[model samples]
Target chain A: MENNKIKIEFLSYSENEYIARGFVSVFASTFNPSVSWLSDVKTAVSEGVTNCIVHAYPNEIGKIILELEVNNNYLHINIYDFGVGIDNVNKAIEPFYTSKPNEERSGMGFTIMQSFMDDVKIESALNKGTSIFMCKKLLNSVEE
Target chain B: MDIKYTVSNNNLTVFVYGELDECSASQAKNILDRIINDNLNSQKVIFNLSGISFMDSTGIGLLIGRYKKLIKHNVPSYIAGATPATEKVIKLCGLYNIMPKY
Candidate 1:
């Protein structure tokens, strides 16, 4: 509900690239983070968004909602989807584990999120849905 | 990310271009795994990373995995063309101590 919070929803399709690029850039610039940090954030968001497209819906159709909130010290990115939830959250974070090996997935989505973000948390059940909450802190700037 | 592999004589050359973040790390691993399994008898494996701009901890994992596989086959591993960013990560992970970097 704050002025710094941003919310957008889009279909979980390959064309989400444009949507992702726009949202990530706005959030990165708003926080005055370095370009390198922005790139990492963008890459992590891409991985999470792509996972929603490829894993969440499967053969069905669905939508993904991205919520971003930025304050002076931290930036939060939340991705949500209403699809078949992950059955094994632990195994899913393994470096080389992939449920869709036939699709050539490397199963590194969650790993990327963990490595790039300051904090990552996943909540879901078998048939409910999945939500990924990530937060990154800005270290350089302070309130004037 | 674009991945290309070339085998000549007894060396396996892997050229990884673009970014090798967590998203593309597994794809790189799978491609390398396939190449190594089918050609386990090679004398050496060379990773050409001149075109790589950015790499994270996952990149380190991939390199170490391949290095181990090559070692088991008695094949030495070599790397070249690492950008500053890539070099910093490699050093942070202490990979240069494990294998030769060019």
Candidate 2:
């Protein structure tokens, strides 16, 4: 059972609270991260998910898939969106960088994700899509 | 997020509450800008973070931007009421060196 992984996908709509509920419910039990750590992770997750809704499709609709896997005391979360892909991931991570500055975005979404998570991996291609793969290690959990 | 503005003895204070992340940062920045512009001659501007429950990197950005604006006019900036977790993030970001957290 340790080898098996669980994945949850939700539609990228403003009304969908399932993404947050699903993520917190699963990670709360699996990692038992500190409250501060949990809040950081949750905020980062919410920011990424919100970006998918605001940036990915523009006027069109899309889906966001959150895949979680536990491996060797580390939890991996992959948030994937098949919408308009990022042209430059580096620029996106830079502080005060925002493509939608007109919308009053602080442009620190990627930076917060990088700052809070242990590891952050982003993969994207123009018009293809963007995927963020993040990992956090459980201080108390041991390898299976 | 909840934002409150108050004036105490010639000083303008802004209290930031709740989570201030990428989404709500602009509001904070804009409000601060307005206060600073309105009180350009005021010497002290205090940001009370007592009510803030969660804050991320965006919070740091918001604070830094305000610091830059206030510094241009020789106004002193102060921070107070940061929780341990919030304080940790502020320290880790080296903002304490720039804007001392009281």
Candidate 3:
């Protein structure tokens, strides 16, 4: 499955959160991910896509890009947007450190991504945008 | 998200089916709040999350919001049938401290 890769680009809307989760779930299903693992990836993908709809493009809408790659025993995910980039990446990842506390944001977006994925990396530039890279290992895929 | 609740013997049981994330958080909170309020006499509230296929931070926010309201009305709440991944998120957020899982 080293050559299987899918990329999706969509508008930044809360409605697309479900689409992202559904699409990723279907894409990862080829690897025979477990129920818990599938759910974890869906949840993480939802948060990443939602962050773009909420924080990245608060004033205006923008394009959100999602890339999925399955190689060896891992599924790699990359979500990035072209909107307002996070100013402080470190503080943003801290639990309960929501920039929009008034919005009922539990500030667990990054935390969830970190907890669910085997590895997570975030990169952002001021006024540019944010990109999240995550990977999950498929534990039960039988060899071809 | 779809929310269905049952009231019996002064207990309110809510069954949520669908994804609970930023997309559905507000809607879930509103629907659940109304149901819980309509059953003000409920002494205990139990939330069934097994039907939920996915959840994110907003899930925790929704649960915490409901727990706070339940507290104001003197109702003890419990979480039941959370999926393995969903339960991991809940436990990581320390929700088990407030609402025990059954």
The TM-score leader among the candidates is: 3
Task: List ranges where model 1 is wrong by over 4 Å.
Answer: A1-3, A14-22, A94-97, A100-107, A141-144, B1-12, B19-42, B53-102
Clash number for every model? Answer: 0, 0, 0
Scored by DockQ, the top model is: 3
By TM-score, is 1 or 2 better? Answer: 2
Q: 1 or 3, which is superior by lDDT?
A: 3
What ranges in model 3 sit over 4 Å off? A140-144
Model 2: chain A TM-score against the true structure: 0.88
Error of 3 at A82 (Å): 1.2
TM-scores of chain A across candidates: 0.90, 0.88, 0.95
Report the lDDT tens digits of candidate 3 across residue range B1-102: 799988888889999998888778888988998998898789899999989877888899889888888999899999999988889889888888899996
Model 1 score (lDDT):
0.75
The residue-by-residue lDDT of candidate 2 on B1-102, one tens digit each, is: 778878878887889998776556767777778878988777688889999987765677678788888899998888989987678667656777877875
Ranking by DockQ: 3, 2, 1
Error of 2 at A76 (Å): 1.4
